[model samples]
Target chain A: MEPVDNRAVVDLLGALAYAELTAFDRLAEDARLAPTLAGRAALARMAAAEIAHHSRLTDRIADLGIDPATAMAPFVSALDAFHNSTRPSTWLEGLVKAYVGDGLAADFYREIAAFLPPADRALVEEVLDDTGHSDFAVREVRAAVSANRKLVGRLSLWARRLVGEAMSESQAVIAEHDRLAELIVAGTGDLGGVAQLIDRITSAHTDRMKTLGLNP
Target chain B: MEPVDNRAVVDLLGALAYAELTAFDRLAEDARLAPTLAGRAALARMAAAEIAHHSRLTDRIADLGIDPATAMAPFVSALDAFHNSTRPSTWLEGLVKAYVGDGLAADFYREIAAFLPPADRALVEEVLDDTGHSDFAVREVRAAVSANRKLVGRLSLWARRLVGEAMSESQAVIAEHDRLAELIVAGTGDLGGVAQLIDRITSAHTDRMKTLGLNP
Candidate 1:
């Protein structure tokens, strides 16, 4: 790994931290869509996990002697817009968003993490560990679809719309943060490299959707 | 402490677990009312802590070979009703609920926790430890009230309404659960004893309200 600009690193951490915060907010609200207490608790647990991840990133940014709020400010609007655009209309839609939408975002971050210095890479990897919640989302979504076959079509369409909105928002954030863009480009070795990185993310996202019986 | 019925203990733990889970849901939703990222993260942290406590209670219920969902099912409607009736209208309202409303509930739970056997009592006390988030709520609510004097009257009314609904819901739950009623009566020594215990809790609640410049 090469030396990354500290400002760029902070930008990345800020984006990650705010992402988790907003994810926590969205998942917590979506948990309300659950028809059962156990189901609600499951989504709340996912929301809790996001906050735990948010804390790690925020703490790191604060350790850098920057106000976490200031560091997180830049990415808030884009992420908030992503959540606003992709608000789930039903319980199954919520589950699919938790699974497909968040999974793609996590994959993109993990890929970005790889080109950073060791410590930052490690932090990103640790916080992006979505394995437990991913399994929960997949199980719940699959069970629901099995019980109501018609939900499969609505959820499949929801997954694609979620990914599209997520990517659009991601692009908007990247465009505004030149330092962060430079860092990602450097990490991946070039803009073409960035394209290749996103391609790998897109492929994994397809697999995730397929696992949930939804189209990519 | 005397040997207590495990059935009753499970009942108590279940209720406590569900309370934490519901509180987590409410607090996480309320976090969106925060005006800034730091403020949002602060409320989310409180929400996260509730889930942590919920996990502790749920695990204990499962260890007793009782399904947590089954145990928690009985108390769901009352709690959901209490929260539904007292949903916050503003960020300050949310903070007041987190402060006064949750504080009152915690005090009542702690008082009731005393009548159980040592291990169960300890678990109750541990899970009811809301000191970290309580301090944050107090600081935030007090600051907001200081900024607007007329805000005091509305908030005081809000606090009163919260306690009234909480008590009504609590009475409804207790009336149905004889085993839990027995546990509490045992802890307090008698019906009169339970009254005395509630008095102590109410007094503490008054002090809490006064601390926030609100009338009891």
Candidate 2:
């Protein structure tokens, strides 16, 4: 195992905390797009779960003596930009964003979790609890695609765009934060290793899309 | 004591359940209007707590052999209408609404809970937990009102609008459901009794508004 960089660990956790907070915000907003009260409540529950995860991450950051806001500040723009770019215009789009977009980001962070020191790794892993988000998302998205075949195409495109924006933001973070990038390479070993990590995230994301009957 | 109307209890619970669900939705929407991430996250947490309460109420409704959706369905429109009518046009309004508006509803339900049969009463009391929503709201709204004295007029108007819309909907619910209304009158014993109850609610609300330096 490569030597750990404490600064990078803090950076990673900060990014994850802000991601969960923003995800909570986005999902809560998207819950409004739900077609029925039951559907809306279900989405809201998922949104709540994100906040639960966020509190854990934020508390963990505080426990580490980092001013959570300072650590979280740099990544807020990148995360907020991704959401702004992929604003869902419909209930179905919101569903896809909550399910697919969140899963992709989760996968990306889970990869980095492996590189984390044990205490921090545990915090990362714990905060990533899905609380049935993927199951609900998959079930709902698949049902929609089954009901309207054309949605598979449009939603597939939306899923692709979400990933495009997310990846660009991910690249921006990597470019700006050398320590975090180094942690990734250290976890995977080198440049090819880093490429493999991307491949892994893409593969998982594609699998999730396919499960929802959307194109990879 | 008035004989418990099982159907009315279910109706009351259903309405409460849906009210909590929509409150969750409205708060989540209002969270986006927050001026800072911390404030946004704070509102989101409150929103999540509403959904948490909604779940408990829905579960208790099922325990009474009512379909949770069927229970929640009737109140959806009234609650949704109230939210639509009182949509906060600014962040301060959102803060004020969460405080005064929800406190009003909670107080009203606290009145109803007193009339409920034991199991239902416990459920209602438990779900209505403020979890310090009023405190968070009061502190935030007071700070804003203090910083901008002119905000007092706009916010006081918003608070009154919120309560007005809420009261009309409250009347509609009572009118539409005789059993529930009967329970209320039965619990308090007649017109003056109901009047006194309203007075109590108004008093609490007035104290809250004064604390925030807004007109009741």
Candidate closest to the true structure, highest lDDT: 1
Off by over 4 Å in 2: none
The TM-score obtained by model 1 is 0.95
Off by over 4 Å in 1: A147-149, B1-3
Q: What digit string (tens of lDDT, one per residue) describes model 2 on residues A50-148?
A: 888877887887888888887899898899898899999998899898888888888888899998888888888887867876687788888889998
C-alpha lDDT values of all predictions = 0.87, 0.86
Could you tell me the interface RMSD of model 1?
Answer: 0.9
Clashing pairs in 2: none
Looking at model 1, the pairs that clash are B115-B187
TM-score of chain A of each: 0.96, 0.97
Instruction: Report, in order, each candidate's fnat.
Output: 0.74, 0.79
lDDT of 1 by residue, A145-209 (tens): 88988887888888888988988898888898898788788888877898899889989988987
For model 2 the TM-score comes to: 0.95
lDDT of 2 at A195: 87
lDDT of each residue in B1-216, candidate 2, tens digit only: 967889888888898888888888788888888887778878889988999998888888888898899987878788888988888888889888888888889899989889888878888888887798668788888888889899999889888888899999989978988888888899998989999999999999998889889998
